[model samples]
Target: MSATQSYAHSRQQKLVVGFSQTPAPTTGLTRQEIRDLSLKGVKTRAASTAGSGRLHGKVAIITGAGPELAIGTGAARLFAREGAKHIYLLDYNPAPLSRLAEALREKYPNTKASPNPMRHSRSTVDQDGVLDLAVSALVDQAIQEEGHLDVFFANAGIIQRPPKRVGGGGDEIAEELRATGRNMGGIEDTEFMEVLRVNTLRWVEAGSNISYAFKSPIHARPWRAETLGIFGLSVFLGIKYASAAMAKTTSNKTKSVPGGSIILTASVAGLKANAGPIPYSASKAAVISLAQTTAYELAGSNIRVNAICPGLIETDMTRGAFEMARMAGKEGRMGVLNPLLRQGLGVEVAQMALFLASDDSSYVNGQALPVDGGLTASMPYIRPKL
Candidate 1:
């Protein structure tokens, strides 16, 4: 069978194993016929179905790239599966980062995955150092490849720890403590400042990455698991303005404004209080606030800004800690917020992220959404007696 016929029969759902269709004459086909054929699920012989090319003409970037970099790995794969022309997987560390890019190449095929230019990488916890560099690098990548930046998924942060108690409004205190001069220079300052630097600032700069993408895939477990992505998760930052700006930037899809989207990953712990470090909670809360505010501010930019608040997402950062907690018999505590009564899946969250990144959400914006399933709002279905 010819490639065109093979793809067509499959696209028409006529065959389960193949999908190739003949192009109805290049310039002679009627618009309605083209639409009908497409609706009927016809594909040109040269179509890539795995990625489906949702991001076919767009660009994107993911940062921090710790083992959780797998989240980006999965998203890159999905973006390719959806047909993103240029999916940039960036990180500071080379080994794991390179591995992530290579792994993506294996799964996605033909997508360019590489270490982001050092000039744009925020290597240290202090984000301001490479803020402009990182932002410009992403912008440059998009312009050089597609002549425009479409979406920015700013997903990276630092200074994470076990949940802390909200004694006398601890989240407020954490935010207050983080605001101290310690961020740049504080006497006997704690790590909150550094956490503030990475989570908040880096997340903000990523919004500025302006490559293209969103929050759903990053926060949902089902999406993450199926797609092997974690794009759907809460971002770490306390600034609502950044998110709002992002929303505005991407939403202004006018003839003059460039089109794009922004997805901020926040934690569910922000929606609820926890007993760990105050800054972590506050940091997440800031991320949530940014999602809401960014949606409002950037609505005019044709840029959609949204926040994804996650709960107990087990990444390398938290896996060991959770396991340690498990070894110490903190199962009850660890399992407190999961709606299905289990740890959430990163890939599931990544799927929500992919939705936010694609054209599917062209009309959605300025929202602080949650993918915690019923967990964020669900009361414990089963009260376990210890």
Candidate 2:
């Protein structure tokens, strides 16, 4: 069979296997019992048949699955629900990572899920050797286990804490400005450089090294040399490398899957000013641009590149913000600016990532899709005229 045909046939077999393993639905529960549970806001896993198995037979990798209610963990759960064959999860913290893997296994017994603890240091990002060793090892592990990688979710990220003086209160706006100033000083500040190195440059390094996994030869080596000289190691490198990886054909002709999808976790901060701290917002803005430009570069190669710009989602990263609102008895005001008038869940953002990963979004590319509940639609000062 031709490679394309083999790919289709393999996917069909995997889907059938998944369907056969689906657990039977509960039949004895009465309508009233179900309603009571629903009214109580009881959460349940999606039944295996809940979705159309959009990611059937696909191999996926999710980085930064740290917090229990994190985007990476949410994506992993959703991917399994959508019938991804194998998921390789990475996180800096071993405790939450293992728990996420266990949760996936219990929910989707037929799917293969593994947790890996990998930490990336500042030296890892700045030094080529360290970055290559870390990123290449991840790609290699995925390939070794599944034989091919269909989707990569670069969801790992860090946010500089708001200044202590700015503790979540009435002075939040002013305190936030102070925090931004402290984190993002003059362009030459070492602390500012550190934030850039972790948030931006590391992504570029990982994206570039991941391209090697697809057996792509860097024909324009001089471009890297020239651009590095000009841009001085910015987020552009990650986009450049990831695009190259996505655009290349499989070195092993026997492997059925060739081109794949990449999903970057940007933020609404990237779309509008003051949404986040200065350094973070700037890095995410770069990520948004990267998604758009790379999608254009890899147009015909069957590789789709996209980004998810999330709004105020509850996670470890936002614990402080959430906690302060709760303490002030103003939790309801958390996401009042958005039309939804409520904060979002991690699963909501993950659902968007699932769309981009699956064939459901095959025609969608180069888009910085916002899962922010219409928050990015207008200026913050535009009040509803009552």
Candidate 3:
């Protein structure tokens, strides 16, 4: 057998042995112990496929990869480890963007990493145009440097805690009120609009720009849309533009596989009420709907669209929430509502994205897969006397 085949065989053997020795945790273990085992499973899988090259020779663009532990950065890191040829990292902050780019380069010397600092503000048409222009420039740079773009991860967004005028004051006040288990009032119109603009409108604009680039005449081959995963609450617009973009086909008579995938980062809030703020929950609900509707619409075109609803994940955006819970001596209660009984990490979400991005999910599409430890399996409430 060839070297590549032999190596793959060895890796398969190792995985089989690993699974045999570490069978799925049973109910005999404590919930915490089970959660730890679940996390260990993820780590083992990652290590086993450390150099598997799932994305070999593919070029990708990942936005909102600012925080080191955020989902976007996590996806970017995993993409590189999986053998993406080149990656263009975009973020509003230069520091984190540079830091992530540096780390990727250090670890994956064969992969090219470029960092771009682009802000997403939609107060004015001019500002919106700026975002469009920035996205266009980044896509252009990727094409110029790498010759083609395979994956576009539109994962940048902002989560607004209701403004003080709405009910709670600042973030601290909001967290304090939430800790006391009091629901805040609706957010002010201005605050709500701002949040919608940044979280929704901006993503639509960026996704369109990237899609346009993919259909541009400069690219010679039929663009393969691996995964267009978006992060944040703006699942509606994110899925809309991304699916539309992926569905666009080249005019050339010759046909290729014509495969594409759109993965939206939805939240458990979208699946049920009482999981998040009013506006946030509403937006996520729209996202889930978009994923289903778009998947149906694009099925004929060989493009698959899906949404991933995550439960309590510990990331930069949720740092405050996690901190508050820990300070209240309820740290272990973070994801107690979920069957897993523990919070998830960003990489866990990345693993799901990778699956949706790869050919393994070619037959799977148009579904809102939940990676929330079975949080959405049933209506969340106290079990009454049986």
Candidate 4:
């Protein structure tokens, strides 16, 4: 059988296996409840299904690859299973990054996985004297070592949530978040300069003033390149650096045209309002725009740029919400608002990333694809029983 047919068969087998493992929900539940139960029925599947080696011999970089439930970590494991040459994992925390790298090595010995911790010190230069070069530095390293870069999944991002505390007002919580200055913009003097620096970039003005702005590795750096090029957030920096690296003609593929896949992790919140906080929504909207504009800008470069906007996925970023629901005994109703009626697993998002990263999406470019369980496809309406 052809490779395509074999893959289809493998997928079918996996689907059958997944269904067999999950029994049908009991009747008498509402339509939405039934749908939710059906979705949640299937346990979290392994990252690799058929191990068809779709990414064989390709070098890929994935940021935000730390937590066990993070989207980047899942993609890293999946990419490695698919026979990637090497996977560079980056995250702000060193411990988790190291752990993930070690795990990948043990599972996929053939694939080289390196953990590069991107420390977010409040300065241009950190202890290692590396100039806050999160994505750019990594891109350069990959090119030097591999002679070419293939897939770059900019999956690093954060969402600021007000801490739950007794006797703390909204203003107090906001102030507390500002004091942390985790991403940028402090409480007083430091905050003003951070705001100015962020605004001077102009492209990310909306997020500059947000003290507790959602951030990623790319957002930690004020400027991506030495010449002060492409001023924006995490995914923006990823597009700028990754695209540049991908466009270069390396020694290994000197005669061939430069080509690669750049996948940005946006959010369904970016597609519409009432989905996320004001700052987060605005930042994600910018991410979607970047994917669109950059695809056109690099039209003939053979580098396909796309954004995957996930919805209600149970990743490290959204673990709190899931935990709250479970604590309230409403875990089963976590994602009932969506047509799918259940929260999506990180592996599900990884599957979408795999599609975009592989040659399967060679012709697909400059698009913002939603992987949100059909959440954005419909408006606010109750599901009626047949």
Candidate 5:
């Protein structure tokens, strides 16, 4: 066999042996216990957890923090462990959010976790307006209880699939594209717009004229759309409310500082092509732009805005790809595009989030930092024997 094939074969053998198809009871632990231990090991080894009161007395909000293995959930747990006074978890799905909140409460008794469902039953107004009300209410509650807002992690997003077209020229083009495993051209107008709306704009409220008059090359535009059938919130609105809450002076603390950290979840796809679907990539690119622009707009206020661009992470969102690779015995091939030569876990991304959310990244602002294991550091090229 060739050197490449030999290496791949060796790796595959290791994977097969290292991870058993089923947990062996010889370890003297239940299946769930083993899973929990593995998770704890990953978190412990990923970074130092020496308690230093990094976020003591700080109130924070994290969206998309519902799933057990999601990046947002990892961040919420990290923040709680690091002494965050309160964490408000928001997600479209209430069941998972509530379960996550309960888990956090059990794991970290000192930290207060509130699971909030970002859903609205009212159809009287634009769906965006309903979201605006829901967000506003959450922020208000955080302020009323904690008296200060410290961190806002805008990590909620969706990887949209274009609906199958029928009986038209567009449908023909879509079929051709799908045959090649490309769906960008097949995406419908409404679906494309929905991705943009849910991924980029954070709708404040209907008929409310909010403007950013600061003279910078970047200009903020008013986004108005009838709530499409899809429902999800975006990062722009998080910045809008979080920044405002961060700027307020709280009576509980003397000599209060008007500054906080806002972390937006972007992706490696946003930084380069072929990393994700067109709409998802474009939306993430907009997120990076929002980070840069908002950092400037909120300048001198001590509120740092930045984006985290993750590469190949094994989360619920990307679990299908991982499962498929494993089923095909191509797990060793996963994440080979990155220098790490392995897939990253959500806790790994959570470490970066922790740094940004804490005072450690106080000087970092308006940057799109990639936690992609140096994938974007260079072009795709095979290593040469020296």
Candidate 6:
């Protein structure tokens, strides 16, 4: 057996595998930064995330597609743009889900709709058989109308707290840990368990080879990669167990939809941290890296996979920043703190998400693409004399 050399120093080792280019791109800088001094003052849109129409006319099920678009809705809309006829939009919060569904209904009148059986009424992770039963129900619903589940957006996740400030000065260590506990473990046991159920475990159980999960940070600093493993290894292991269970399922309904795909949602915190809890940053970093490992392990079944690393898009997770900055104008804060000097809209990240979910990204596997408007790439001067 050939010994595998450590990738500790190679540029390739630092890169997320299967992306068109290594390390993806930061927020403001294009994949190619020509650095035109004359054009520095002008704004230029990068090539469309909707490149080449990958998800056209395919069916997709997007979980937690709340109006606020915590993660998956952006991609769902892009899926519609990609020609998806049936969109199964699901979410726990009825108000936003209904509103977003209404918007989508207006956008894609021709597309069939079955709004996820109304959560918790046999649709929530809280219900014991709900996850498995709902999985079959949703897939069956699609198969019944659309013939088969063509594209699956396993983007169901929750980041519950209203949002809190983290990463204070040297005097704030204790407060940071306290804040992290809330992020790591919810105030209510049921809520916390529910977080793990939806945010971490369900995609594995649902035959979704890919998933995206994120949360509000309790700290604003990066953690050693191992810390993330401790938090998320259970979910990765859960995926293993879930895959085994699916192998033994009495039915193999999804046998015709080609193969499985998973895109675990992570954040800039994972790779680069501006300010947040250690657990949140560490776990997110783990989410992305573990996805790399999982991509390697689960490759036998034609299951392509990847990750979506988003920065301060409008969501419950980053409300605190909004509170600190104030107004829609505060999108600048997302960029201000970030090297990119601009925050990203949910739709921006969503498009990239749809690509990974659809066959358009067939060659793309096990990568982490950042949608933070260049947040991670820019670092602030700390030492005053570096």
Between prediction 2 and prediction 5, which has the larger TM-score? 5
Off by over 4 Å in 2: 1-51, 117-131, 161-188, 203-219, 223-257, 382-386
Q: Write candidate 5's Cα lDDT for 1-386 as tens digits.
A: 56776675565454344442435458865433454465568767745565578888788888777787899888988898889888887677767777887888898889887454333321011112216565657777777766888898888787665346645665443443343355657667666666677777533334334333322222234233443232235687788878888887776563288889999999998998778878788989999998999899888989999999999888988766777677778766566555444667898899899999999899999999999877787553333465
- What's each prediction's TM-score? 0.60, 0.71, 0.71, 0.72, 0.75, 0.60
RMSD of 3: 12.5
User: Compared with the true structure, what per-residue lDDT tens digits does model 1 show for residues 176-213?
Assistant: 33433132243223466445545664323233223333
Superior by lDDT: candidate 4 or candidate 6: 4
Once fitted onto the true fold, the runs of candidate 4 whose alpha carbons sit more than 4 angstroms away are 1-44, 117-132, 161-230, 253-255, 381-386
lDDT of 4: 0.67
- Model 3: per-residue lDDT, tens digit, 179-230? 3343445456555555555555432324433432323222223322232433
Pairs that clash in candidate 2: 204-238
Worst 10 residues of 1 by lDDT: 121-130
Per-residue accuracy of model 2 over 141-233 as CA lDDT, tens digit each:
555555677887877776663345634455764554446555344334444445555555542332332232223432243334233422312
For model 6, the run of ten residues with the poorest summed lDDT: 121-130
Candidate 5: clashing pairs of residues: 202-237
Top-TM-score structure, candidate number: 5
The candidate maximizing lDDT is 5
Clash count for each candidate, listed in order shown? 87, 1, 0, 0, 1, 23
Error of model 5, residue 271, in angstroms? 0.8
Off by over 4 Å in 6: 1-53, 116-137, 143-147, 160-198, 201-257, 273-275, 327-331, 378-386
Q: Whole-model Cα lDDT per candidate?
A: 0.51, 0.64, 0.62, 0.67, 0.72, 0.51
Tell me the lDDT of model 4 at 228: 44
Cα lDDT of model 6 by residue, 274-302, tens digit: 44454446556666776687667656646
